[model samples]
Target: MVDAFAEDEEPISLPLHASSDEIGRVFNEHAERRSATLRASTERAIRDHFAEAHDGQEPPERIMR
Candidate 1:
Protein backbone atom coordinates (compact mmCIF):
# COMPACT_ATOMS: atom_id res chain seq x y z
CA MET A 1 0.00 0.00 0.00
CA VAL A 2 2.91 2.36 0.64
CA ASP A 3 3.85 1.86 -3.03
CA ALA A 4 0.49 3.39 -3.95
CA PHE A 5 1.77 6.75 -2.68
CA ALA A 6 5.32 6.23 -4.02
CA GLU A 7 6.52 6.44 -0.42
CA ASP A 8 9.11 3.74 -0.78
CA GLU A 9 11.74 5.99 0.80
CA GLU A 10 9.68 6.20 4.03
CA PRO A 11 8.98 3.12 6.02
CA ILE A 12 5.56 2.61 7.61
CA SER A 13 5.59 1.09 11.09
CA LEU A 14 2.53 -0.73 12.39
CA PRO A 15 1.85 -3.33 14.98
CA LEU A 16 3.07 -6.71 13.81
CA HIS A 17 -0.42 -8.12 14.37
CA ALA A 18 -2.26 -5.29 12.67
CA SER A 19 -5.46 -6.41 11.00
CA SER A 20 -6.56 -5.62 7.43
CA ASP A 21 -9.20 -3.21 8.71
CA GLU A 22 -6.65 -1.37 10.81
CA ILE A 23 -4.27 -1.03 7.87
CA GLY A 24 -7.01 0.21 5.61
CA ARG A 25 -8.11 2.79 8.17
CA VAL A 26 -4.56 4.06 8.52
CA PHE A 27 -4.08 4.31 4.77
CA ASN A 28 -7.37 6.18 4.36
CA GLU A 29 -6.57 8.65 7.15
CA HIS A 30 -3.16 9.32 5.67
CA ALA A 31 -4.60 9.82 2.21
CA GLU A 32 -7.19 12.29 3.47
CA ARG A 33 -4.55 14.34 5.29
CA ARG A 34 -2.32 14.39 2.23
CA SER A 35 -5.23 15.43 0.05
CA ALA A 36 -6.12 18.32 2.34
CA THR A 37 -2.48 19.50 2.44
CA LEU A 38 -2.13 19.38 -1.34
CA ARG A 39 -5.38 21.27 -1.79
CA ALA A 40 -4.25 24.01 0.58
CA SER A 41 -0.87 24.31 -1.13
CA THR A 42 -2.46 24.60 -4.56
CA GLU A 43 -4.92 27.21 -3.35
CA ARG A 44 -2.09 29.23 -1.81
CA ALA A 45 -0.11 29.13 -5.03
CA ILE A 46 -3.10 30.27 -7.05
CA ARG A 47 -3.82 33.13 -4.64
CA ASP A 48 -0.18 34.20 -4.77
CA HIS A 49 -0.20 34.24 -8.56
CA PHE A 50 -3.37 36.28 -8.70
CA ALA A 51 -2.12 38.65 -6.05
CA GLU A 52 1.03 39.24 -8.07
CA ALA A 53 -0.92 39.73 -11.28
CA HIS A 54 -3.17 42.28 -9.59
CA ASP A 55 -0.35 44.14 -7.84
CA GLY A 56 -1.14 42.55 -4.45
CA GLN A 57 -4.89 43.07 -4.82
CA GLU A 58 -7.33 40.24 -4.60
CA PRO A 59 -8.74 38.99 -7.87
CA PRO A 60 -12.40 39.28 -8.81
CA GLU A 61 -14.78 36.85 -7.13
CA ARG A 62 -15.99 35.62 -10.50
CA ILE A 63 -12.48 34.84 -11.63
CA MET A 64 -11.73 32.98 -8.42
CA ARG A 65 -14.85 30.92 -8.79
Candidate 2:
Protein backbone atom coordinates (compact mmCIF):
# COMPACT_ATOMS: atom_id res chain seq x y z
CA MET A 1 0.00 0.00 0.00
CA VAL A 2 2.84 2.37 0.79
CA ASP A 3 4.44 1.67 -2.52
CA ALA A 4 1.12 2.06 -4.25
CA PHE A 5 0.67 5.47 -2.67
CA ALA A 6 4.18 6.48 -3.60
CA GLU A 7 3.57 5.46 -7.15
CA ASP A 8 0.37 7.42 -7.30
CA GLU A 9 1.87 10.62 -5.90
CA GLU A 10 2.98 13.12 -8.51
CA PRO A 11 6.69 13.85 -8.56
CA ILE A 12 7.67 17.33 -7.42
CA SER A 13 10.79 19.35 -7.87
CA LEU A 14 11.70 22.39 -5.79
CA PRO A 15 13.39 24.87 -8.08
CA LEU A 16 14.85 27.98 -6.59
CA HIS A 17 14.10 31.28 -8.24
CA ALA A 18 16.24 34.45 -8.06
CA SER A 19 15.18 35.49 -4.56
CA SER A 20 15.66 33.30 -1.51
CA ASP A 21 12.91 35.05 0.39
CA GLU A 22 10.47 34.49 -2.43
CA ILE A 23 11.45 30.83 -2.51
CA GLY A 24 10.87 30.51 1.22
CA ARG A 25 7.51 32.21 0.95
CA VAL A 26 6.46 29.92 -1.85
CA PHE A 27 7.52 26.85 0.10
CA ASN A 28 5.71 28.03 3.20
CA GLU A 29 2.56 28.71 1.24
CA HIS A 30 2.71 25.28 -0.30
CA ALA A 31 3.11 23.68 3.11
CA GLU A 32 0.23 25.65 4.56
CA ARG A 33 -2.08 24.66 1.73
CA ARG A 34 -1.11 21.03 2.05
CA SER A 35 -1.65 21.11 5.80
CA ALA A 36 -5.09 22.62 5.35
CA THR A 37 -6.08 19.99 2.84
CA LEU A 38 -4.94 17.10 4.99
CA ARG A 39 -6.65 18.55 8.02
CA ALA A 40 -9.95 18.81 6.19
CA SER A 41 -9.71 15.34 4.69
CA THR A 42 -8.87 13.68 8.00
CA GLU A 43 -11.63 15.55 9.78
CA ARG A 44 -14.18 14.28 7.30
CA ALA A 45 -12.87 10.74 7.50
CA ILE A 46 -13.01 10.73 11.29
CA ARG A 47 -16.48 12.23 11.35
CA ASP A 48 -17.74 9.43 9.15
CA HIS A 49 -15.90 6.77 11.12
CA PHE A 50 -17.02 7.90 14.57
CA ALA A 51 -20.57 8.60 13.50
CA GLU A 52 -21.11 4.97 14.62
CA ALA A 53 -18.78 4.70 17.63
CA HIS A 54 -19.96 5.30 21.16
CA ASP A 55 -17.33 7.80 22.35
CA GLY A 56 -16.52 9.00 18.86
CA GLN A 57 -13.96 6.97 16.97
CA GLU A 58 -10.53 7.25 18.42
CA PRO A 59 -9.36 10.59 17.08
CA PRO A 60 -6.84 9.99 14.38
CA GLU A 61 -3.27 9.91 15.60
CA ARG A 62 -1.71 13.31 15.06
CA ILE A 63 1.66 11.96 14.14
CA MET A 64 2.91 12.03 10.58
CA ARG A 65 2.59 8.25 10.56
Candidate 3:
Protein backbone atom coordinates (compact mmCIF):
# COMPACT_ATOMS: atom_id res chain seq x y z
CA MET A 1 0.00 0.00 0.00
CA VAL A 2 2.87 2.33 0.81
CA ASP A 3 4.37 1.70 -2.60
CA ALA A 4 1.11 2.81 -4.16
CA PHE A 5 1.98 6.44 -3.32
CA ALA A 6 5.76 6.27 -3.25
CA GLU A 7 5.93 8.26 -6.46
CA ASP A 8 4.32 11.21 -4.75
CA GLU A 9 7.40 11.65 -2.57
CA GLU A 10 9.57 12.30 -5.57
CA PRO A 11 9.84 15.79 -6.99
CA ILE A 12 7.58 16.65 -9.90
CA SER A 13 9.60 17.85 -12.87
CA LEU A 14 6.78 19.95 -14.22
CA PRO A 15 7.49 23.63 -14.80
CA LEU A 16 4.43 24.81 -12.87
CA HIS A 17 5.16 28.01 -10.96
CA ALA A 18 3.68 26.70 -7.73
CA SER A 19 5.70 26.84 -4.53
CA SER A 20 6.95 23.68 -2.86
CA ASP A 21 4.40 24.11 -0.09
CA GLU A 22 1.62 24.35 -2.65
CA ILE A 23 2.79 21.19 -4.36
CA GLY A 24 2.96 19.38 -1.05
CA ARG A 25 -0.56 20.46 -0.16
CA VAL A 26 -1.87 19.18 -3.49
CA PHE A 27 -0.21 15.84 -2.95
CA ASN A 28 -1.58 15.61 0.60
CA GLU A 29 -5.10 16.31 -0.62
CA HIS A 30 -4.82 13.68 -3.33
CA ALA A 31 -3.54 11.14 -0.85
CA GLU A 32 -6.41 11.88 1.52
CA ARG A 33 -8.93 11.45 -1.29
CA ARG A 34 -7.41 8.13 -2.27
CA SER A 35 -7.44 6.90 1.34
CA ALA A 36 -11.11 7.77 1.70
CA THR A 37 -11.97 5.92 -1.48
CA LEU A 38 -10.12 2.84 -0.37
CA ARG A 39 -11.81 2.88 3.02
CA ALA A 40 -15.28 3.11 1.49
CA SER A 41 -14.57 0.34 -0.99
CA THR A 42 -13.20 -1.91 1.71
CA GLU A 43 -16.19 -1.33 3.96
CA ARG A 44 -18.60 -2.22 1.17
CA ALA A 45 -16.68 -5.34 0.25
CA ILE A 46 -16.57 -6.54 3.85
CA ARG A 47 -20.28 -5.96 4.36
CA ASP A 48 -21.16 -7.77 1.16
CA HIS A 49 -18.91 -10.69 1.98
CA PHE A 50 -20.35 -11.14 5.46
CA ALA A 51 -23.91 -10.85 4.23
CA GLU A 52 -23.38 -13.51 1.59
CA ALA A 53 -21.58 -15.75 4.03
CA HIS A 54 -24.49 -15.63 6.45
CA ASP A 55 -27.24 -15.93 3.85
CA GLY A 56 -29.86 -18.57 4.72
CA GLN A 57 -27.94 -19.51 7.85
CA GLU A 58 -29.82 -19.96 11.15
CA PRO A 59 -28.64 -19.59 14.73
CA PRO A 60 -28.16 -22.74 16.75
CA GLU A 61 -30.83 -23.60 19.32
CA ARG A 62 -29.92 -23.04 22.98
CA ILE A 63 -29.47 -26.06 25.24
CA MET A 64 -31.76 -26.25 28.31
CA ARG A 65 -29.25 -28.25 30.38
Which parts of model 3 are misplaced by more than 4 Å? 1-15, 56-65
Candidate 2 residue-wise lDDT, 1-65, digit = tens: 12333333434345645387767776677667666766677677677767767474566666775
1-65: candidate 3 lDDT, tens digit per residue: 33435434445443488898888887787778778766777667767776788887653454768
* TM-score, one value per model: 0.67, 0.56, 0.61
Better of 2 and 3 by TM-score: 3
Off by over 4 Å in 1: 1-11, 60-65
Can you give the lDDT of residue 4 in candidate 2?
33
The lDDT per prediction is 0.69, 0.61, 0.66
- For model 2, the local distance difference test gives 0.61
Question: What is the Cα-based TM-score of model 3?
Answer: 0.61
TM-score of 1: 0.67
Segments in model 2 whose C-alpha atoms lie over 4 Å from true places? 1-17, 55-65
Residue 18, candidate 1: how far off, in angstroms?
0.7
Candidate 3 or 2, higher lDDT: 3
